[model samples]
Target: MLPSTYRDLLRTPGAAAFFLTAAVGRVGIAMTSLGIVWLVHGRTGSYALAGLVAGGFAVAEAVAGPQLGRLIDRYGQGRVLPPVLAAHAASVLALLVLVAEGRPGWLMAAAGAAAGASIPQLGALSAARWSALLRDGRAAELPSGFALESLANGLAYLAGPVLVSAVGAGGRPEVGSVLAAGLVVGGGLALAAQRRTAPPPAVTGPRTARSKASAAVGPRAGRSLVRPGFVVLAGLNLAIGVFFGAMQVSVAAFAVEHGVPGAAAPLYAASSCGGLLTGWLYGLRRWRAAPRVQLVVGTAALALGCVPLLVAGSLPGMGVSVALTGMAVPPILVVATVLTEATVHRHVLTQAFTWLNSASAAGSAVAAAASGQAVDAFGAHGGIAIAAAATTAMAALAAAGSRTFGPPAAKRGGGFGSSAPKRGGNFGRSGGV
Candidate 1:
């Protein structure tokens, strides 16, 4: 039976509102990539141009993500989120208008990049809220929270493209972007209203030995951006992104080769379904292995699962392989989220998560370019080889970092939930939101 942990978490003040809003926003963001690609292809009739513009959007987002997260860390979410989201909505509208009006490709790419850069770091923000709320003895509940995030992400990928296609049905692709903008605006406002769960900012001042030492060594309250532990964790997520990107290209290529291009969606859906089911089961039980061990083991399992892809000849065979391979994905993500929370101070927690997000985006961008070349030269086999190689690299890195994952060296009393935030900061006084 699935545990009622999610229900219990939802029962907490503001959790339900925040999560629902986050989900709506996430689904909208998911739609943008496919929508952009389709819109560009429709306008230009060149797959190369469409792919290039889409790549530019992803690259811009990856570059801007950390900087935005830093702003959110320094200022509070309520202060920082609304303006960025507004800009994002405007950018989306601009891109849709330009595409519909047959504007130059450069102009379209520019607008798309703006929209991508301004996408609210909703996943990272939600995790940080849950981290703040679950501090102290309730820390064990974090795995369940992270699992919920994984489920949301899986669902978004599964459903978002469908929504985009439906909106674009019968020659109306621009409607998709309009709908996405509305969802982003609505969700951002709703989440920003929930100031009660916002984490306090970390102390920033002239560097001291204690601060420097804590940053170098393990201390939960240490400045996390400087820590090697967080760097390694981010690297692991980057590798996971490479595997994901390569697998996607490989699946699309395989489906095309089999003369069933439409089968790509079902094949990808199989993987998402597998991840979603495992996420539910994973959250039902408390974890035992150290996060480091789990990261290594989960990565290794993913690589092993992909081995079947080498022999998969038909769509059904590939679908089964993809599903089995995807089962290992959510656990790695959940462990990575837990590790990020453990290494970073609560104040900068959102920034740390955004760094991971950036790393993943970078990895995906690199993989997409490389996999495209490989698929053209050596077909789907080459793409699967890339996926396997990336996962193997991730496993190796995780194993090397195993000894580094543990409780912080210096003990900080109480939890972040117990810390009193400074007065006159952004977001004003906490309310029932």
Candidate 2:
């Protein structure tokens, strides 16, 4: 049964439309990387070139995400998404055409890069909308909203690979790319159509004399990346990304090493199931712990969870360990979303969220390469070791920056349901940085 909070949230005007559409759009985003890899490899018969092209796509998306998010924040979704989605569609078509013609690998990679650079950050944008909708007295619903978003992401991840792989197995890998492209454009446009729910663009007009005077007196504010606590959050998420990348490779390698290569998918699915279950449950209750404290504990738990992976000699044992590890991920992400919403300026909230996504993408790309090397040099256990090391670094980073994260709701004299002051609401600690 759905929780009342989730039911109530979906009942909000335009909520169901945007959420449903964004969920659809994210499935496309999830499909693109694997689709590209399959298409390229099938066409060219070179895993090396396929991986390079796919890696370039990921790196381009990570590089472009924050800048695109900043534009979305400044111009609003209605004004920005249409053109961006159009470009994405066009670039994807170009990629397909280039591949069909047996074009040079570099040309195909460039086309993939263009497609990736324009992929919308739908999940982050949806999160920003939830923040705007659930503000004031409805703040308690924020966690549930974020949890639903995380679940949507998980579902998309699961569906995308299956869909792409199934199509590829039928001997037309390019069809998967086409399907992903269509979904990305269609879902993005659907979300953009929900203009009523879109957050207002940040006011970037000329500063008034009084505001200018204050700005002159205070430290000059820059982008969200430079914000005090935000850097720590981004760093922690990067490490979490490393854990994800390493864990994926390690589990697959372990399964193959034990002569049960087919077991890899089910084992990873176990981790996903654990994450979805915990994320759903985590959103159901309001915790008294500070966001910072939750983050610290979450990272610590994740670190401990990864430790078991290093020692698991059997598939069943590894499944249990991976599931435990997956259980820790969603809560950390939920807390990170809560904290980002609380601390970032409302104007740049979407961009702030994108920065975290970008960080994770960057980390994942790096870890995938590093873990591949480790797996080659020292076998499956080496990859597991890398996963554990990443989580430990994440925990250490969380502990070090614990102080910068603001006090708990109790200290602030309010709980999750409490409203912020109207003038400079808790939405952004703009001056606190």
Candidate 3:
């Protein structure tokens, strides 16, 4: 079933109204945080620099993400959010001030880093709350919510970069900063409006072995935050990250290197949004087949699709190559999403999501910077090759981990879901049976 009904997402629970309120805030925060890319690029006149700044933001968020999720799990959102929001506001304001003050590139990078680090827990925290509000069995709601969030992500990809480029071209990076600041402010206000609506947080003190094992979960899954199925999922994600990061940098860098730098934004936006349009349905597939099968095949298909890029000769070819590449992304992301939601405990679900998301960020930060520099030295195809190598390495890891990664152990307090490689929609395990 679809996660929350369309009406349900709009409705507020008696005590969890805050979740709905926070959703709006999340949208604003995402929209505006991204707006800074155009702003910063307009100021610096370097796409690589813009990417670095954005990568810094993503890196800080990725590094701190698991820790932040832990914080939310350890403390109530009420206790955690306000101060972080305040600090976030201050940091962004500092960034704005520097922009206005005409700060040097290094100074801008430093300010962006601080702001990115302090950007509060808007998206991550909001997701946690959404799951919580669905506690009274709106389970379908959560997945749909996620799908909608995914769709929203697509919208942001389309709008944020385009909007920033438009405004930046008007000769004002400050405009982008101002737009980011305004969204932050509005998001804060929206979240404040949600104070009374959110569900109580589900964090309990860390579950010790016996106590946790006593629950309905398998013994292994009951203990570590990691689970067997989740390992497979995360493992696949690790490779997927290399693919995603490499693609991002490759597109941007290739566009510039190929003399169609202006084509970069639209090409990526089309690729992502177009793929996402398909992802929603992919998520809705009601796949009774094992996710392991889907995962391996998905990864291979994605990888194969990427191989076409070696021959991309024009702006149009670039777009086609990217769009085909996009086809691989959603299946992996959605399958991972399903596997994780199915296998993970509810209390730590947000943290699980956060951790998985962190993997991609970690990969992107490391790969984007490395690949960007690689292109400068090795040229576009060489960068592409390196990226392809990185991604293949990831796929190989998932394949190796497949032995241990299987269906959740059946016995009580057993282990993770079973992970036997199957046929058809296989993920990273190649086409093997």
Give me the candidate number with maximum lDDT: 2
Query: Candidate 2: where is the Cα deviation over 4 Å?
Result: 1-3, 203-224, 407-433
Report the error of model 1 at residue 307, Å.
1.6
Higher-TM-score candidate of 1 and 2: 2
| Span of ten consecutive residues with least summed lDDT in model 2 | 424-433
lDDT of each: 0.76, 0.80, 0.58
Clashing pairs in 2: none
Candidate 1 residues 83-153, lDDT tens each? 99989988888887887788888888899899889987787878878877777567667778788888887
Q: For model 2, state the Cα shift of residue 191 in Å.
A: 0.9
lDDT tens readout by residue for model 3, 288-337: 45665555666667767767787787778878888887766765675566
Reference-based lDDT, residue 223, model 2: 45
| Candidate order, lDDT descending | 2, 1, 3
Best by TM-score: 2
- The TM-score measured for candidate 2 stands at 0.90
